[model samples]
Target chain A: MSLLVVGSVAFDDLETPFGRRERALGGSATYFSLSASRFHPVRIVAVVGEDFGPDQMRVFEGRPIDLAGLSKVKGLSFHWKGAYGYDLNEAKTLATDLNVFADFKPDLPANYRECDYLFLGNIDPVLQLDVVRQMARRPKWIALDTMNYWIRGSRPALDAVLKEVDILLVNDAEVRELTQEYSLIKAYKKVRALGPSTLVVKRGEYGVALFTPDGIFAAPAYPLENVFDPTGAGDTFAGGFLGYLAWIERTDVTALKHATLVGSVMASFTVEQFSTERLEQISQDEVRNRLALFSDMIRVEDL
Target chain B: MSLLVVGSVAFDDLETPFGRRERALGGSATYFSLSASRFHPVRIVAVVGEDFGPDQMRVFEGRPIDLAGLSKVKGLSFHWKGAYGYDLNEAKTLATDLNVFADFKPDLPANYRECDYLFLGNIDPVLQLDVVRQMARRPKWIALDTMNYWIRGSRPALDAVLKEVDILLVNDAEVRELTQEYSLIKAYKKVRALGPSTLVVKRGEYGVALFTPDGIFAAPAYPLENVFDPTGAGDTFAGGFLGYLAWIERTDVTALKHATLVGSVMASFTVEQFSTERLEQISQDEVRNRLALFSDMIRVEDL
Candidate 1:
């Protein structure tokens, strides 16, 4: 199965309670590609610039990710710097250099148009809707991740995109913020009314919850000893999630539930180090080990 | 299968974002008995004063709970005043008058002495241990709930009690504080090393995690539209948990998991109103309704 992911591809400087790191290979597309590549061949559509180096390219070199759709524009790549407090859940943006990313017009490769699965990472909701319009054929499943920025500033565009996506992925707070509903159940029902058949609420370090018309299933965040950085954990979650769905060739409620578990396992690795440091080096065995942990963390006797 | 609950029976004044109530029926034992009575006849060992009236007793009067161990002493009943912020998760104690509960002693009724299950509510650890020693027959399972106050101020007594208990129930922050470990996994190991066969780390609103020698299991908090007041939610959880065990006539791991579900159902009701207002008026059908909701909330098919 082929998977298409569109979002930012850039560098990040992040600091957390565990430690700090300088400009590292980061961005939504980078983490998404790395995580999704573990399960299926991924096609990345994003714009990077001159600063996008060979070292970063090597991160995805041998993987089955096609960068034909990844553009190398002029000037510096998008750069973001952020710091997290002890909570490690909320990030304060220190700086953002959009660079070439400011004019990012995701132009999917001709071959990418027919990908079986699509993931629109956190970006402008209007742009996300445009990408969905560009797809040659309707993918088996289309999942989206969004931020408070769009939900607050571009409600119409977000609502437009929500009406088209098969799944909506968001953090706990953003779901509450978007729906103005404090209770998750009510918020989920409101999101569902917007058109997505499935809603996945991401709770950092806690777990993920999946809401489908059929039922609701939740999986706890795979417990970790240390969280070095939380940047891109959400996108990495989306990568593993959609990637697993493509790998299994199923988007039923059952597959979505299993995909939530896979997403949690991938996210646990993403937080162990800054950006994609830990995620880039994770092996299939490592993924399997974490999936085992996920199973153990959520296994309860039938009551 | 009789159950014994030893804790305070008090009057409480509470304020929440929703509203406020004064001199409401509240306390660890009050919530515990009201919830546990659903499964088995609960023998409550607690101290109240003249201030404790029929209005308060009415909360438990019709339930299958024995008041033989409830004592009324001189002066006012233990009085507590608290308020919850918009989050409804954090409680700020405005006032605490221990009153009769300050110098109280738990004298288990002769009929309660042979209870197979014991739930030691949040109270002085020394008093908790004293009740254990006074039991005519050793309970098959003894679960203890504690807070940071006792963990820091009464470590020795708490440690002694921990050695004698079968399970330890505490909040996530309390577990982190008690073990000085940032990760719940490490915290669980440290807690298990202290002697309990099982450990439950409760994350308010997020859900609860159970760690046993065999593995880990988790259940998300049953989502609700509004939380009027959170007082006594924890003890009510304990009551439902232990009560399920007594009802099933077993304390095995399977029973523990079922108890966790019952606990979640009970807590969903506790948060809906102040003190035992919602829990007091809850019916068997209401319990089943919430149980079905809990089931719907976590139901997921394997990929």
Candidate 2:
């Protein structure tokens, strides 16, 4: 099965309480491709610049990924610098150098258009919808992730895209911000009303919750002793989630619940080290073991 | 199997963003006994006063619980008044009347002395250790819960009790304060070093995590649409956790994970209404359905 991902491929400088890293290979599409390539062949539809080098390309070279859709423009790749305070959950942007990424347009390759699964990582919501329009045949499942920036800056575009996607993935705070509801249950109901049948609320450190019209299911974040850097954790989650659906060829309620777990397992590896350091070395056994651990973490007995 | 719970039984006046309720029946022991009675017979060792009436006692009258250990003093029962801010997780005490509970000295019945499971709810740590000493036989599992007050005002007594208990249940903030560790995982490790085999870090809205020498597990709080009052939710969680273990006769790692789920289930019911209102009307089916929902909430597939 083939999966298509659309977003920016960039370099980031991130500082956390643990330490700081400069010019780390990061971005939503970069993380998503690395994670999704583990389950199925991924076709990446993103724009980078001349500065984007072999080291970054090597991160996904051996994996089952096709970067034919990756376009190279003649300038710096999207660059971002950020710092995390005591509340690691929130990030403060120190600088942004969009360069080629700011004015770039996503052009899907012929093979990518017919991919079975599509992932719209955090990006311009209008562009996300435009990518869907460019598809030759509608993918079996379309999953999209958004952030508070789009929710505040482009609500109309975000809401329009929400109606076109099959699933909506967002963080807990963003969910609350979009719905203006304190209770997650209410916030989920409000989001479901917008368009997507499935809504996954990602809670950093706490875990993720999958809500559908049928009911709500949740999975806790795998317990990690130390989180070196939280960069790319969310996109990695979306990757695991959508990639699993592509592998299983199902997006039913049952499959979506399973996808949330897969997402959680993938994210656990992403947070272990800065960028995708530890995620690159994760074995199938480690993923399976953590999935089992997730099962045990929330198992309840008949009293 | 029999379980003994020693804590406060009081009348609480609470105000929240939802509304206000005056003189609602609440207290640590009250919630603990009600939840524990569902899994096994519970013997409550607590003190009320002349104002404590049959109506309040009726909450547990028909359940498989023995109130013989409850004592009625000559004065008014303990009255606690508190208000919750927008967050609802934090409460500010407006007034506290210790009343009969001020001088509480637990006198366990002969049968209660041989109980296998004991849950010492939030109270004076010195008195909690005293109850342990009064037990005829060393209980197989002893669980203790405490607040920041004892962590500050009664560190010596709290430390003494920690060395003797099998499990320590505390909120995340309290755990951080107790151990002087900002990280929850580090805090759990610090608490474990104090002698308890297991430590539970409760995050009010986020949920709870169990840390044992063998492994670690966590469960998110059951999402609720409307939280009428969060009073006694933690104690209710303890009741469900300990009750499940006492009923199944297991205190191993597996049981600890199961207990966390049970605790989460019980806490869901506790927050539905003012103090024990929803809990009083809870049916076995309700618990089973919630457990099934929780099971669904955490279901995920192998990637």
Candidate 3:
């Protein structure tokens, strides 16, 4: 099963306690594609800028990624500047320049219209709906990620896309904001009522939790001694999660549980470095080893 | 195996989003002894004032709790007035009248000294050390709990108590404050170097995590739609955790892992209502059922 991700391919200026990087190859789609490509082929429908050259493209090279729909436009790409204090869980956004992304319109290629898995990253809910409409056939799974901005500003549009999504990936704050409910269980119930059957509440350092009608499953963040940067961890988590599901070709609870762990394992690596540096260079063996360790860490045997 | 807990046992006036209770039976040792007594016999050593009458004592009735060390002084019992908002994770302390607790001197009974397992609740480290010293022979396992007050004010006393502890259970903030390490892994390591081989970081709502030289184990809080009050959750967790260890009579990593989940299960019930109301009325069947459910929720089958 093929995976299609529609998001941004841009640059980031990151500063953390460990180190700093400028003009880092980033963006939701870039991280997602790199991470998902590790397990399955990913078709990315996102726009980059003219500044994105061969060096930047090399990050996706040798990976099972389709870039036909990744348009290289005339202007600069989406650039974000953020700084993290001692608390890596929250980032303080210094600036966000939605250059080419402001007037951006996702134009999926013919082959991408039939992707089995579709992930609409954090974007305008109206644009996300447009991407969904462009799909020739409904993908096997549609996962959408939204932020507080969209949830608060353009709720009607956001609700429209959410109705068509099977899984909704957003941070814990976003879930609370969207539902206006403090209790996570109640918030999840309200979210499921809106449409997406499963809600993945990503709690940065605390870890990620899955809320579904069947029950809830939670995985703690891989205890890391050094977190260099946390820029694209959420997107990387989605990529790895959807990628694993596509690889196994299963969306059942058991598979979703395992995929959630896989997603956590992938996100663990992303925070070790800035942007997609670690994700681009990670090997399958590394992922498998971490998955085994993580499974051991969280698994509780029968009494 | 016998378990002995030494901490404050008194009254509480609590206000939460759900409701309020005035002069409820509460305290660290009260919650810990009740939660632990479900699995094993518990001997409690703490001071309550004359106001703690038969009704207060009845909270521990029909349970395997020894009140031989429960001293009834002339003055008022320790009373705490607190409130919780929508975010139940943090509580606002409106008032804390130590009363008799201020001069609490834990006088362990002869039989209590030989208990196989011991838990020193968040009390004066000096008093905790005194309790440790009162033991005829060292227990099979000794766990200690502390707070930022002691960490910041009584470093020497805390360090002294830590040296004699086999396990240290404290919340995440306390861990960071005690070790001055931002990374939890590092903080756990630093804590291990101090004394206790096991560091149980009790993350209130996010859940609890165990950090040892061997590895780390994390358990998410049970998904609850209604959390009436989160007053004694951590104490309840410690009780359930050490109680399970005593029940199985094993201190291995596997036993610790299972115990951690059991602790989470016990704490889940504690927050369902205020004070010890839920803990006192909960049946073993309910605990076992939830433990089974929790085990199933966290268990990851082999790929």
Candidate 4:
């Protein structure tokens, strides 16, 4: 079964305490596609620009990623400038040139209609809904990720998409910001009330907690000795989560727990270096080894 | 075997968003003794004053808590006044009056000297060492909890106690604050370098992470609808952890994981209301029920 991912594919200028990179390949869809493709077949629907060079495009040479929906318009790609210091939780945005992404619309490929799994990455919630509308057949599982930018401003559209999503993933502060509730559990309940049957609240470096109608599942963020850059780690996590589910062919509550652990491992790797560089380096066995350790970290005796 | 706890048993005036409590029965040893005594015999080594009323003393009437070392001196008991806004992470100290506690000494009863498990709650490092020195027989397991104040101001004494203790439990920020390492995994390693073979870094509202020579174990914080007051929650967690360990008669890696979950349950109960009131209200059945749910929350398919 194939996985369909839709969001931005852009050039990112990032500065961190470890180092700096100019025009590094990044975007919600880019990170999501790179990670999900590592596990299952991925079809991406996103827009780039003429300035997005072939060097960036060649990153797809060996991966099972169908880029038929990746269109190159005659303008600059979505370019974002961000910085991180001692605290990796909050990214300082210096600039954002929406460029070609400003008027972007997701146009899913015909083959994408057959995808068994779909991920709506962080983007305008209205566009997220548009991607869902374009789907020829409803995927078995639909996971959506959105940021505070949409929750605070485009909530009506966000709520519309939330009503349709199987899972809604947001970090700690974003959940609080969205619901205006100080307590995380309260915030979680409010999100569930808005319609998603399952909620995955990402707490970078702390962990990811999943709430389902059956019950709750919590997995700690894999403790890392170093986190070089946090850019796109969340997107990478969403990809890893949906990718694993697509491969296993299950989206039950129990399966989501495994997905959360898989996502943690993928995000752990992404943070070891900037952008999706680390995600590109690890093999399937390496991913398996981390998953095994992660599984061991939470092994409990049956009561 | 009995569990030995040593720290100040003081009165606290606190203001939280829920409400305010004046001169509440609050202290590390007070909370720890209340939680630990539920599982095993607990001996408290702390000082109060003539002003310490009979109502506060009756909290231990039916429990297996030996208050032989709970001395009532001539002056006022140690007093603390603090406030918390919506953010319960950082408590703001409005005033502190360390009347009798200023010149206090822990006078452990002869029976307490032979207890098998000893927990040194958050207190002066110099005083913590003194309690160990007073012990005629070394305990089977010694768990120590201290704040950043002692970690920074009394490194030598803290180090001395750290070398002797078997377990060191600290919250997330304290470990980072103590080791000056922003990365939690790195910070865990640094704390292990200084002393204890087993370390539990508590993440209030997030959960507990256990680090041993063997490796790492993670547990989620028991989700709560409300956290009325967070005062002494950490101390209650320490009591729950050591209490379970004392009952299980082991401190191995596996045992520590179970103990972490137990502590989480205990801490969860403590925060439901102000001070130790919630801890006093719940029955053994409620604790076991919550622990069962907690175990179920992380139960996953073997990978």
TM-score on 0 to 1 scale for chain A of candidate 2: 0.96
Off by over 4 Å in 2: A292-303, B74-76, B85-87, B97-100, B109-111, B180-186, B252-255, B296-303
Docking class of 4: medium
Question: Comparing candidate 1 with candidate 3, which one achieves the higher DockQ?
Answer: 3
Writing each residue's lDDT as its tens digit, candidate 4 over B1-303 gives 778999889999999999999989999999998998877878889999999988999988899988888888899999999998787877899999999999888877777788789999888888888899888888888899988888789989998888878888898778888889988778877877887778788888888888888989988899888998988888989999999889888767788888888889999999999988899999999999999999998899875
Model 1 chain A, poorest ten-residue lDDT window?
Answer: A293-302
**Backbone Cα, N, C clashes tallied per candidate:** 0, 3, 0, 0
Ranking by DockQ: 3, 4, 1, 2
lDDT of 2 by residue, B1-303 (tens): 679899999999999888888989999999998998888888999999999998998898889888899999899999999999867889999999998988899888887889889998999999999999998889988999999999999999999988989899998778879998756778888888886888998888888888888877777788899988898899999999999989988877877877888888998899888889998999999999988787666554443
Q: Of the candidates shown, which would achieve the greatest lDDT relative to the real structure?
A: 3
Q: Which stretches of candidate 3 lie over 4 Å from their true place?
A: none
Give me the displacement of residue B120 in model 4, in angstroms: 1.2
Candidate 4, A60-123: lDDT as tens digits: 7689998998988889999999999787888999999999999898877677777678899899
Best by DockQ: 3
- Model 4 regions lying over 4 Å from their true place: none
* Model 3 docking tier (incorrect/acceptable/medium/high): medium
